[model samples]
Target: MKKHNYSAGPCILPQEVFEKSAEAILNFNNSGLSILEISHRSKDFVAVMDEARALALDLLGLTGKGYQALFLAGGASLEFLMVPYNLMKENGKAAYLDSGTWASAAIKEAKFFGETVVVASSKEQNYNHVPKGYEVPADANYFHCTSNNTIFGTQMKEFPNLDMPIVCDMSSDIFSRVLDFSKFDIIYAGAQKNMGPAGTTLVVIKEEILGKNGKTIPSMLDYAKHIKAESMYNTPPVFPVYASLLTLQWLKKLGGIPAIEKINNAKATLLYTEIDRNPLFKGAAAVEDRSNMNATFLLNDEAHTPIFDALWKEAGISGLPGHRSVGGYRASMYNALPIESVQVLVDVMKDLEKKVSKTRL
Candidate 1:
């Protein structure tokens, strides 16, 4: 049975990306050297790195607009600190919008550097809705937010128009939709979600936003230093970078972000429509704030859990289980997830409804 992967991170990638990556792993660039053994500074690897950076900006429509892209070793978790370290000035405060677990985590890291004021939060309702009507102070060094909440299945569909700089953790839905990338001063994402494997994180920083933090930052955490070295400050995640390059190449061939956004919307609509129509299940997040990337839902009646479980499992569905914090199902529909997989899940839901109907009769 073909597995329909819905795992949140380190999740499904394009089949062609996988095949090409596999070949490169064995003999990268037909150079007879395993990609695993290739040097990060090698000419071939350098080209891969360059292309990956270029493709990321091109997809976001930020190329040559004073924004620089970097592929770094630490995941988005590291960026949680690096963002504040490089941007948050000493005694200067930052505004954070708390929508989910990862957003809260980013807030925590920001507090370590300087003052971090949570302008608004949806935590009062278990992060089921995105916060709205928040006031961002102009004195803040930057306004930081997580563009999508993977754990709670919420996403910020409408971004705030802030006079201050805007920084975001787009880890879950970076390339899944179209956005005005110019509005963001910094955008960071872990590749595991929508880009590639789990070893690299993509960071796009507007060049002028650096060097204002006032504190001496470690070289590795300094965004300006990384930009100076062209993200070759230290040995990078070579294999993961190569794989990301292939994935980006595939995305370009598929006509870039605009094309993928349409497909992603279709996938999300299919899954969410089932969640709403199925009497057996209910959505976890607020309808307005519901994420197109991760759909969290639960069986309305826990007694039917076994039947529903069997239906999806027998249909070869994986990673539909929700986070421990939210005891339900979370179907993460990233850029690479096919609408057919969503149809399978929806069909299972409908089947469960039919079975229940006949049982009641």
Candidate 2:
């Protein structure tokens, strides 16, 4: 049976990337040495690291002047604390936008390091929408936000233009669209989602923003330490970093972010359109606030879930079940997901519609 992957994180990757990456794992660049066995300090591996960082900057349209890209070990979750640790001072407080689970977690971590002021939050509405019209503190260290919430399927449609440095967690939708990197002081994402396999996190930071906090930070949690060491302060996640490099190569070949954004939009539109039009299903998020990456929806009759699940399984569709927190179906349409996969899902929904009509008659 043909399989369509819709798993959220550590999600589906390009077949070509998997194929090439697999070959490298066995023997990288025909060196007769597996990529896993090579020394990270080796000249060959150094080139891989350099290319990966370069591709990230290139795809994000970040010129070398102010931005420095680093591939680190801990995921963006670590960055939650690191952002405040490096940016927030002894008396400094940071502003955070609480949109969903990840945003709240970030806020929690920031509080451990320093005072964190929640500038806006959608928790009152169960994170169904993005909070709007909140005042950002002028004296805050930096303002942090999650660009897209994977579980809730809501996105910050518009970013606030603020005088303070902007920090964003783009873990779920980093390269899924075109972004102005200059507007952000720092941006970080776990490689598992749109980038590559897990075990590595990508960070793009403004060079001038580091070392401002007088409080000493653990070397591992310090961005300046990772930057000076070129992300080799300690042993890095070589395999995941290499896989991310391949994904970046794939992204570049597909005409960079501009081309990928169109395809992403088309895929999301296909699934969301099906959900909106189908009587059996309804979208979970507000129309304007819907995420282009993770599309969350629910069955009209909750009891019909099992039937819907069985039908999709028979049709070779998988991983459409929503998160427990949301309790429905979530189809994660990341950049690597082909349009045809989404069409297959739409077809499944249409089939279910037919089945329901027949039973009613």
Candidate 3:
């Protein structure tokens, strides 16, 4: 049986990426040393790091003049604190949009550092919709938002237009669509989703936004420090960086973000259409706020759960379970997930309907 994987992060990567990465791990770039054995400071590794950062910026249409791309060791979770540390000035405030768990966590982290104003929030709706038309404080240092909420299956389809700098955590849907890079002053994401494996976080920041916090920052936590050093202030996550570079190369070959966005929309449409048409299933998030990356749905009858479970498992499908906070099912159709995998899931849904109809006879 051909297996299909639908896990959210540390998720599926291209087969070619895995194959080439494995080969390079043993003897990278035809050099005798393994990728693991290569010194991060070595010229070859420096080139690798430079190219990876450059490719990421290029993919996002970022110009090096104002923007600096860094591959840092700490995940986006660390960025939840680093963002406020570098951008939030003394006696200054930052605005946040509380969409889901990660967004709430970021707000909590920012409070420990300085004052943060949650201008808008969706907790009242169980995070099923994005908050709209919030008032951004004119004195605010930056406005922060999570581009997509994985657990709640909601996304910020349109960002709020604010005069202040915009800081975004694009962890779930960074490269899944075309974004106007100019709108954001800083964008960060963990590479595990839609990029590559874990252990590295990518941050693209506008230089002017840094060095204004007026607070002494730890070297590792300072964005200005990393930007000035070209993300080489210390040894980096060499292997993950290399893999991320390869993934970026693959994305370019596949016609970049625009092409991928078309396919991503199609995959989401296919699954959501099935959910809407089926009597046995219903989508969890609001129609206007539904996420294209993570599609959450539920069985109409709780007793039918066992049947839905067996249907996918017997068909060699996997990782369709929803997060514990929001139960039912979540199909994370990340970039590397081929459209065929989604078709297979849809087929399973149709089969389940047929079985249920027979049971009613």
Candidate 4:
């Protein structure tokens, strides 16, 4: 049986993308050259990059709305600093919502640039719920929030309407759901998640948001420079970008974000319903704030852990263990994760429950 991959990052992609990517590795576009060895400047590769960027914006409904998508290197971690570097002035402050580990890291980076006011944090509660009623400092340069907390399985369902620019790190749930992508001024996600592979990062910026911060950003960190160069500033992550383009193309062919959102919701619902309905388990995150991409849950009895683990493993479920910081399980149901895979896990949970009931009686 094939394993149901649930790894949070570097996760599953559509099988068609895998097959197509494999073919491209051997012969790309019938050019008899590998996509891996193609120059970023080549017409074929450029078209790939161009389509990837445009399609990303198109999928997000940001095209013709003044947003430019760039596939850069260094991941979302790099964007943590690059965001403040390009958006915040030396004296200006930024507002952040501390929802989980990544959100804390982003706040730490912004502090180096200037003041980083954490409007609200659910850290005290182990980041099991999205913070609410927090006010973004109206005078701040930008308000930063992570759309989905992959670590804690909490997602921000609604964003604050702010006068300042809105920045979001949507690494784990970029194309898993539909949203008002235009509401955000800057949105960045690492390719390892829903996008494609790990080498590249997608940065979607509203053109109006750039060059406003009176700071001399280094060429490498400046979004404006990358935008001016059409995301060709320095050598890009060739293979990951190409793979990401394949994923985006896969997404587009599948009816884009809106269509995928429904499938994602169904997968999440299937697994989460079992987590809640099963007497052997309970969700780790707030029910209202539970993530549609990653669902964190725990066995009600530690004594059952051994058998429960064995059952899922026997059922070919992989990457179900939770993050080190929070133990239990994290079912990362990304775009490419089929509903059937989710059903497999749910069946395992039901089987475990039935066994527990039989033993108890």
Candidate 5:
């Protein structure tokens, strides 16, 4: 049986994406060559790269808006280092918001470049909520924030209005909803989440945001250089990019972000409603800031853990355990996760409640 996948990343992808990616792996473009063996510079792979980049921008409504989308290696972790290197001057400062583990990791990277100021943080609250009413220093070179906290299950409902450039790490929730894509000068996400599998990280940057930092950025670390190379700065992650293109094509066929957003909202509502209505479980994050992509919850009584765990597993659920920092259960409802899967989990929850009630009798 195909289990209901709730793994946070390298997570679920469309069934069709799996089917198509597998075919390409064996016989890409029917070229009689495995996707793995093709040259990155080959016309076939170059067209794949070009379409993926364009489709990404087109979906985000960033096409012809002065933004160039690059599918590069090194994941979001590399972007952590590169963002500061290209945007922050030696003495210049940058502002960040700390909401979860990934955000904290980024803050650490930014500090290596120059003065890093944290505008506000919810660390004292164990990141159960996104920080609000915080101030971004106007003098800072740019303001950076993470759009979603995968581990903590919190998402930013709104972003800070800034005078300078705005950058966001949308790693865990990119392409899962509709947003004003043009509001930020730079947006980056690791493709492992909503976009595709691991290996390539997508960076959509407004071309005008490059340069003027006055810092000598190394070749690979420079956004302008990567854009000039048309994201072929070196051999790209060919297979991941191709798979991501398949997923994007699947998404487009499903009617783009506006279409998927409706389905995503429905799935989140179904699970969250059950969490709130069922006496056995409770949500881990603030209701106002709860993430539509990842929903973290816990049983009301820890002693009931084993029974609850067995019930879900028997019901074909997988990857429901929460992060180590937040021990409970996390239902990661990415773009490809169907609502039927969520209904199954809800049924299991109800079944568990009935079983426990009978035990008390």
Candidate 6:
């Protein structure tokens, strides 16, 4: 049976990437040494690092733009603290927009370092929509936001144009769509979603923003240290990084973000349309702020959940359960997920409606 993967993080990656990564595990680059056994500093591995960084910058259109891409060990969770540790000064304030769980976590970490102000929050509405019309203080060190909220399935449709530096946690949605990368002073993502496997984090930072904070940052958390060492400050996550590199290569071969965006949109549209039209289901988020990456919905009647669950499971669907924070269904459509899988989910939804309606009659 063919399986459709909708798992959130540590999520779906290109099958090609999986195959290549598996090959490297046995014999990397015909070197007779597994990627796991190879030294990160070896010339061959260095070349891999160089190419990966170059590809990331190229795809983001930040090549030759004074931005440095670093692949580090900590996931986005560590970055929650690292962001303010390096950017927020002893007295400086940072503005945050709370859209979901991840964004709130970021705000919590920033507060430990300095004044972290939440300019706007959708928590009052259960984070169902992106907060709008909030002012980013000119005096704040930077404006931080989570571009896509995985748990609540909401996304920031538009970014605020602020004079201060802009930082984003793009863990779940990076490389899924095209964005003006230059607008952000820093962008960080975990490798598990839309990139590759877990164990690595990607950080792209404008070089000038570092070294401004008054408090001393730990070497590992310091962006400048990572950039200076070319992301070899400590031994990196070799396996995950190699897999991510392969995924980036696949993305490039598929015509970069512009081409991928169209496919992602189509997949989201197919699933969302069914959610709206299906009599048994309802969307959890505001339509305007719905995330293209994570689509959250719930069944109208709790009694019918088992029927729907059995239907999709029988159809060979995996990872359809939503987060415990928000009980329902979450369909995470990452870059490599094909539109066919989405259609399968949609068809199952329609099938459930048919079965339920006939039973009622």
lDDT digits (tens) for residues 1-361 of candidate 6: 9999999988888889989999999999899999999999998799889999999999999999989999998799999988998889888899999999999999998888878899999998889999999998899999999999999999888998989899999999999888999999999999999888999999999999889877788898888888989999999999888999999999999999999999999999999999998888999999999999999999988999888899999999999899998999999999988999999999999999899889989
Off by over 4 Å in 2: none
Superposed by TM-score, candidate 1 places the C-alpha of residue 114 at a distance from the truth, in angstroms, of: 1.4
lDDT of 3: 0.92
lDDT of each: 0.92, 0.91, 0.92, 0.93, 0.94, 0.93
Weakest 10 consecutive residues of candidate 6 by summed lDDT: 213-222
Cα-based lDDT at residue 328, candidate 4: 94
RMSD of 4: 0.8
State which candidate has the highest TM-score: 5
As a TM-score, model 2 comes out at 0.98
Model 3 Cα lDDT, one tens digit per residue, 1-361: 9888989888988888899889988998888888988999888899989999999989999866578899998899999999988888888898999999999999999998678899999898889888987888899999999999999899889987778899999999998999897789999999999888999999999888788778999999999889888888998889999999999999999999999999999999999999999999999999999999999999989899998899999988889999998899999999999999999999999999999999999
The sequence of per-residue lDDT tens digits that candidate 5 reaches over residues 1-361 is 7699999998999999999989998999889999999999999999999999999999999999999999999999999999999899769999999999999999999998899999999999999999999888879999999999999999999997788999999999899889998899999999999988999999999999789899888999999999999999999999999999999999999999999999999999999999999999999999999999999999999999999999889888999999999999999999999999999999999998999999999
TM-score of each: 0.99, 0.98, 0.98, 0.99, 0.99, 0.99
RMSD of each: 0.8, 0.9, 0.9, 0.8, 0.6, 0.8
Residue 225 CA displacement from its true place in model 6, Å: 0.9
Candidate 5 local lDDT, residue 128:
99
List where candidate 3 sits over 4 angstroms from the true fold. none
Give the 10-residue window scoring lowest on summed lDDT in candidate 4: 133-142
lDDT accuracy of residue 106 in candidate 3: 98
lDDT of 4 at 13: 90
User: Which tens-of-lDDT digit does each residue in 198-312 have in candidate 4?
Assistant: 9999999999989988888899999989999999999898889989999999999999998999999899989888998898899999999999999999988999999999999
